[model samples]
Target chain A: MNHEKNIIELKNITVRFDGETVLDNLNLTIRDGEFVTLLGSSGCGKTTTLRIIAGFLEPDEGEVFFDSKNMNGVPAHKREVNTIFQRYALFPHYNVYDNVAYGLKVRHVPKDEIRERVMEMLRLVNLEGFAKRSVAKLSGGQQQRVAIARALVLKPKVLLLDEPLSALDAKLRKDMQVELRNIQQATGITFIFVTHDQEEALSMSDTVVVMNEGRVQQIGAPEDIYNEPQNAFVADFIGESNILDGIMKEDFTAQFSGHTFRCVDRGFAPGEAVDIVVRPEDVDIVKPEDGMLKGTVTSVTFLGVHYEIIVDIGGFKWMIQTTDYAGVGETVGLSIDPDAIHVMKKSKYSGLYGDYSTFSDEMEEMNQMSEELAEEYAEELAAERTEEAGDGAEEAGK
Target chain B: MKNRTFLRRIIGAPYVLWAAIFIVIPLLIVVYYSFTGPDGSFTLDNMKNLSDYGQIFKISILYSIAATVISLILAYPFAYVMSRKKEKTQQIMMVLVMLPMWMSLLILTYSWMNILERQGIINTLLGKLGHAPLNLIGTPAAVIFGMVYNYIPYMILPIYSVMSKIDPSVLEAAEDLGSGSFSKLYRVILPLSMPGVVSGITMVFVPSVSTFYISQKLGDGKILLVGDVIERQIQAQNNYNMGAALSLVLMVLIVLSLALMKLFAGESDENLYV
Candidate 1:
């Protein structure tokens, strides 16, 4: 958080495109050797933030700093930063080695040094023997690794990755997530990764910057972001949360579900409204007589490691994930320990998201979006190889 | 989907019949006529006459190659600029490119004739500038200009389409890797658009070499391209046998161009479409 330790700083960065504000006076500081993720859904200014840092998109009303230098007018090439584009964007005609060596060649490095660096980078990505292979012939994950290799071969001060794993399959996405985190740690270079995947943000990043609607909701450590979301959107976006309307009666006591419960969060005036969030994994089901609240099981789904069960209590649905299963229509008692109860000041979107609907809705939307992005990229790759000409605008029939 | 399959097969029947009747049969008849004499008897006379048109063939290739090179030099930047423009501007440029192609080739050449003549637009404009009118009409330059003008759109369309489809991120990727503007263009944009460049060359070269009207009007019989010789053989000379032989030579030229396209874009039918 100190200026001396920050590798990149965006000072009141604002970007507008065709009269629409994409980034509205956003400020963020990334520490040296830190892996920070800009976590947000679509149209949330995450990619725009990454581009401004890479010096590809200049902010309309603010200055960007790299190592305490003004980077407002610096072109992308002049900046000591590199970006792994969303779709890899590898040179289709170049082999893996040439693609990775392109930067060295541009910098006029010696042939021997270029070869050694390229080989080292390829080996780093575990593609040592694949230097001669055409990138067009590579699989999705292989191309992604090639992209990373190409960006990191320069040994830049900062590396910006824009949803680099969105094109891979589920299993490969998980594998690359771990591989990427390990690579970043090994290199010890500052990384600015942008993704809409909450699980990826939580698992991979040292610091997570939660964003929504072109504004920074909160920026903190991954655990801090998960445990203490600043508002309703952060609680909703980070993970599955059972958010309920509650009233703060007094210090450390909150009223919800037609009953009073103890909560650790305070500072709100007495008799004031608040939003309470309880993570699905934290809520435990207990015996009816010894439970905090009694509810009836509405639905149960087996999710391999855990069973996702929804319970209806006081006319509100609550999602609970546990190893134990609950049959539908069975009466179940739920207990939220004092620490599991989180209180947030209600914002404009208070009580807008239901517990049962938000989880599946978020999952479905993200899965669908991930698939669509992959499919479009696949089509673009096919188009690249086969060169689909526009219309039948030529006299040559063939 | 199942119901549409039957109807689709039915819809395709007409194209099958048309190819068999028009394309396949005509090609077979040309092959038969190439081997026969005026009396419809098998002879080697037409093959023997192939040497008579050798110089014309040489001239055709030279002029078309020169025209195709010039067109490439002129169209590359134009197409690149068009590709970088807004969607509305691209549409307008496309309309302008296709406008010249829609008119009959003969009319276009005649219009060029009007411009390149001794007392025509260029000369009249030069006379107004107090300079002597230069001779361009009935020269190789006039014929080459005609070919370049008519075939310019052929080169522009494929290149523009390919350039516009290039992911903007690829260019940014090149820039991010410390490439200058020239390096980005020479390394990335040019290599990725090679398929379009190949198709454009083939499209322009084949038609430019085989067009008789432009040479006849602009060359005015002073410069005899192979197409004009073939026309004279068939119409002015009444030598069908010799014309068919020369026509076969032109066919070889077209087939060779197609083969060159195949060599450069050996990837798929989608690339071959351009």
Candidate 2:
């Protein structure tokens, strides 16, 4: 219902540091008054993108447009955007009032107006009586509020926050997250937030831009992205998923785990290899004969809201999160509803992958295992070659 | 745990004893000498000879202040540009700045004597260019030059270490908040780098105020400062009481300056390096 024209547009922005690509020809468009989140793990160029928009950094190649105006060479001070940095880089020398009044002072606003506006901002962030206190005297959450108040006082067209809540404790961080969303809605400013926390991104953003290794993996609404991930990385990164290798026979039918199952997918070549992902919460533990596959529960970890159960189905590991507790060493059956199975095109680390990451410990273990398997295969080939040589000599003697 | 704590305190006994013997006992002796006469009778006459040493004391204090200020001006930009370079480049600069300190100060001053005195390097080169010889050395300028050259590395090290610890996020935030380069430097960088500056001043000024050999060598034994006054009173005149009194006065002045700097900067010295 709140569709608006694009307020900012990034056209193929690319950035490199130390001869290594940090952002590879990335493009994104943000609508007016939209709360967009760039979600990724560390070193995915989310901070770099935010800096480019704030004019603290210039992309090596591509143009940035602010409301259809070219903004390539503009410095940060000249631009109308402000940023809330990580760790809340408040000036230790200034009190809270002067810190909030800084942007207006830069523009040479009137003395009375600056005070009134700073007071108004302090009240908005609920730090009304903390005007005369020094920045270092405030607590972490208080300092974070002061930072937000300082950035919001200027009423920039777009505000960039670089993991602003990352330094707070978990309870305070949750409170601040909700407070930030409310503030953005009240002020009606475009908020581009960068965080490595997926839950924070999904809970707060109107659009989530999932990035991996200098490339944008997907961009969509949170619900759509969660329900219909485009590839293996999205499926794995966003939430708990059991990604299994499967073969598509035709429309509405797929074969996986040595069993044929119904799935709501089409337009695939018969007997085509594909990745089928099902959310852990979507799976149900049923009777051993009533389900499609049978497995024994290997471990169950209590996760507050639910229990996370790891099952071994014919030497393949699958993680399931369910409210119903299943005892370890019990034979269980996993039943996936046809609509819950999401078929994806295999691109990178798709089939039978859990916690997909390029440089994670799991990935490193997989690499070593593959190397060992290759060594065993080479030994077998050498043994066959020697046997063939012996057989030829015997045949010639005969 | 209590026994372990007692053991830890026992381990520090040697340092405590060493400090008491070498530092505390000597300071007490100086204090005692400043308040008594050669006959061991309580007297104030030795400290009351202020008029005799006041002129040289004034000149020493003024010239040291000048040298300290000049060294700060030179070392700040040097350390700033150096700290902003690549780590390898900074390491190279570290070697270059510290290389001069490894040589003995006497040797270093004697070498400068060859460069600044008449028929020295500059005047010889000028005469070869068909110019008349100029009075080259034996002045306050040459003494100050030697002091500044010798003590500059002290100023550079403290400032360099502090500047490197400044968080990059703070500068970026200043720019993002619409501060231009000059305002950013004025409002943020300079205030944050004050700890470095004050420590640099302390290092340079303390030595400059008490130096006599640099002046004696470069000034050709003509000019004298408070340090020369102390040397004459103690060694040549054999008056330890007056020398101890003058040292106490100099220590008070240095301590007062340090207190003023700390009051203004309003920050503690957390990182102290020699």
Candidate 3:
């Protein structure tokens, strides 16, 4: 028997598009019956990685293993996996039942058996009465359900979904996401979903692999990736964060935003530069002088369950979400838990998320200065264009 | 309510007039001629005299069907290859295929004569090699050959247009769904390209049924087809009524062929849009 526990393993995966590296050397392992989600921003190579795993694309340098077998020569059909594309890709001429029966028919299964399996798959996807209905006759949500039935009827060992809900409306997308998770549970099949939406990844995936610029930044459970991000990219990508540039003081305390904050780890030597990443929800807003950092609320947004507050702390604008409402321009204090700060080393991948920890005041001053300069440049360009147009009008009239 | 508007009525009047004058008039002429007798009386003489027209009907139908089937066999491969070409190459190839169409078919027929005639280029080459000149000129082979060569573009172009519109992703999807080469061709490519094949057959067959030029020029006027019979009746025999009657018969055959083509293709308008 094949050792199917480690159903899919991608080692040192790398992909490039027109000389731009989309996936750096990446490694991932998906266990049998485990639901994994590749989560990242658009252009982060998460979909590229998924396509490579699905055998639609070949990695520049990597090995994809299925059940300990090197899958280099195995075509997508030969491999024990099926994909449900984002567009659904249903055969327009075929009815729902015929589409589901296609894979079985290709396998040369008996006609009666193909019907039985197709019927069963339809039932599984809750599309029982849709057998004779043409695929084009179905709504988008129904078409997606037909696509699910079509892919699942083959009983593949692993199913790859490339942002299957991305085409649906918001309510339908959410409903389908839950239904997808429940279906995966019912089938007990491995599902590797690729998506840019973090909340969808968090909701559906047993393990979330956050990627950026073709390299995986972090891979962990949803809660772990959110609560304890590995790097600055992860922290920013997984959720909203307030970053601060700070210098490590004696014994692991860092000074930033005109306040001293204690941190859990003390690896950095005294006077060394580092960046502190704290999620917006983790920062406590309070009355001035009663917190570690001083700030003024610039804007407040109600996000249904919480309030998202943009605060000007020292000169840096920090977005902090709280249940407490604060008026614009109101003075506020910022307090972070000692273990909340995530320190990141300076790397080329920095500047992707704006440098959060510099003097908050200096950062705001620089931002305002840049904004003023930008306005002046735009005005100058507009004036020059108007002058050119005036000269042209006179020339034409003459 | 909108149908009663002055502008709508004004616009619609011309179309109805045109249909009645140009289309319905000719169709009535054909139907009347089909039912008219030899003495200009309203009788079923033309219909009863179908036995006399049987040879024309059978030959035209058989030859047109044969030509369509042959053109399909030839065009399928060309269409497949052209559709698979890169964009620039496909454009260049399309231009090349359409180049012959720019030249008159009569001119092309003369060119074929130059190559196909006895003691012509083909026979000259064979004779130079010490064999007798082959009697290929005044044969059905020559007629079919000329028909297929001239109308091949008609077959290929329509098939190419239809085949090229088929999504490559659908083919790939089929492969990923475990379809081997044969099954993929039969299941996906062939079914999807039926519209083109249907259009191509209609294009080649309709004109081929009444095509007198190829049979006249290539068959040396000895080979009897419906086109030859019509030409003889109208020009040599000086029987316009008989010619018009036969013309009506051919028109009816074309209409019937069109309906048959639609039935055989079995593709809906929705399938084409998709």
Candidate 4:
């Protein structure tokens, strides 16, 4: 909550690889003891930004300032920052104790002090008696704790975590999210996390910076980002939204889906083209005769807490999530409050999302399946390389 | 299920037969000859005669150890450099390392002889450069040089393979934790690559200790090794008993050294073999 001064600043940063721009004219600043997340999809340059901050990468054109001092030409080892890699790159040869003590040993800290600090960090991460355990023998979650302890033992000014929990199961990931937030608050170290999971970002980050295609779409608190997205991409990416093309009639008024509605957004030119965002949970289901806009329910799915119904209104599908039961082929009406309707200026991402016409549960499942398959393929490739190396060793032995 | 098991056994019959014929039978024959006399009776004479060639044994052990150490020192840095290159460059460098192995060992040793002989290419070049012609061949150094040059690829391959498999992120993590380049290598890279180093030493030392061709040509027959003596006893002197005895001793020595290495490597022995 302390927004007094900037701990780190990146100005006009541009990075190009193989003649392709990965980050373009990007600028960002982080405050001390803040938990900021850079959220985006794959190839959206979130990891690249984290790497730039970690000093593993250098921007082609940019100025990086740490504590208000220009940090150009500083190597990663000379900086006061540490990174937790995606795979928890612990030294396989070292046990948990040695891994945590590596930094202290490299600095030639006193042995007794090193042991005390290492044990203290282990206690912080809840790995007290696991100092002698081999890293490979530990479970994924345990290894994650060791990696955290290793980096935080150095007491870095800033901790950069690049999707540290992405490899864990869903339930464990949720637990770690809360644990990570507690750790950040307890230690009061600046944490700059990078992840592609929007839900993870929204739940954990004090400030979420939504990114798309090498550009910052929006930056705000989680509630503000979810409720009042500045653009169509931010609205669609943050959660499910019913985005429709609309015209701003005047201040506090908008027209969409052949009906004018009252909204809280304003300051737009008269009759300006815009995008209107309607959250699925904000719409109320009513009888068709007493409703504002009437529609026929096309599909209904029970989602544990609510029933998600897709309604067809004037040939456009609108998703509504409510506890009310709406059967398919039944006529229904939707009621929208003025505060529930969010309006924004038109962006390049307009019309690219926010439609449920081609959406299905199977399609979402298929997307998850493909991601799992890609992960499996990468693991298989690594196994194959290890086998090849084994074969090479045998041949050399012969 | 029974039928599939039968089929699997049938498919594996050839390898079993090949091992019994080529490997197992030959070893048994060596063991037999090692303990028998010329009259086909058991005797301890052959084992006792080994003490007479103590000098040859010492020379062979010393030269091979020297060769193995030199190869390791030269190949570690080279393999480390090669492993850090881009993929395309790494492949090219790997191919270059293996290209010399495709030729015959005798041919390679002959080539080294031509390069190191008194009036060969190196001496000729030195003479033309207005320097006195140094004694380039028929020395212990030339024999060690030949052994190193011929077997260095074995040392490089395993080390390079293991080094290349080291996750780049681990090195980055080391740097992130405030380790300089030297500390990173000494603490992280070297310890991780120990399996490769142990295997490389084994691969280089085994053949160098038992090699006959390099010492014969490069040593000018003056610096005889255990292999040369075994070869002379079997082919020229027709003394298979003494030859088998010497061969058995060499095998025992190699196995002992390998066991020592595995012990030193500790838990990393899981990765010592394929």
Q: All candidates' lDDT scores?
A: 0.88, 0.88, 0.83, 0.93
**Candidate 4, B158: how far from true, in Å?**
1.1
Instruction: Identify the CAPRI category of the predicted complex in candidate 4.
Output: acceptable
**Candidate 3 or 2, higher lDDT:** 2
What candidate 2 gets wrong by more than 4 Å, as runs, is A1-3, A355-398, B1-20, B31-45, B267-274
Q: What ranking emerges by DockQ with the best candidate at the front? A: 3, 4, 1, 2
Q: Each model's number of backbone clashes?
A: 0, 0, 13, 0
Of 1 and 4, the candidate ranking higher by DockQ: 4
Model 2, B1-274: lDDT tens digits are 9999899889989999999999999989988988999898889987788678888888998889989999999999898888789999999999999999999999999999999878899899999999988775888898898889999999999888888877777778888889998888887777777888988999999999999888889888888988888888899999999899888888888899889988977653432111
Candidate 4 Cα outliers beyond 4 Å, as residue runs: A360-398, B1-17, B268-274
Chain B alone, model 2: TM-score? Answer: 0.92
Residue range A264-337, candidate 3, lDDT tens digits = 86777888877778888788887887888887887787989999888886567888878989999899888889
Candidate 2, CAPRI quality class derived from DockQ: acceptable
For candidate 3, the TM-score is 0.87
Model 4 lDDT on a 0 to 1 scale = 0.93
Least lDDT summed over 10 consecutive residues: which range in candidate 1 chain A? A387-396
- Quality of model 1 by C-alpha lDDT: 0.88
Single-chain TM-score of chain A, each candidate: 0.87, 0.89, 0.87, 0.90
Error of 3 at B218 (Å): 3.0
In order of TM-score, best first, we have 4, 2, 3, 1
Against the true structure, what is each candidate's TM-score?
0.85, 0.88, 0.87, 0.91
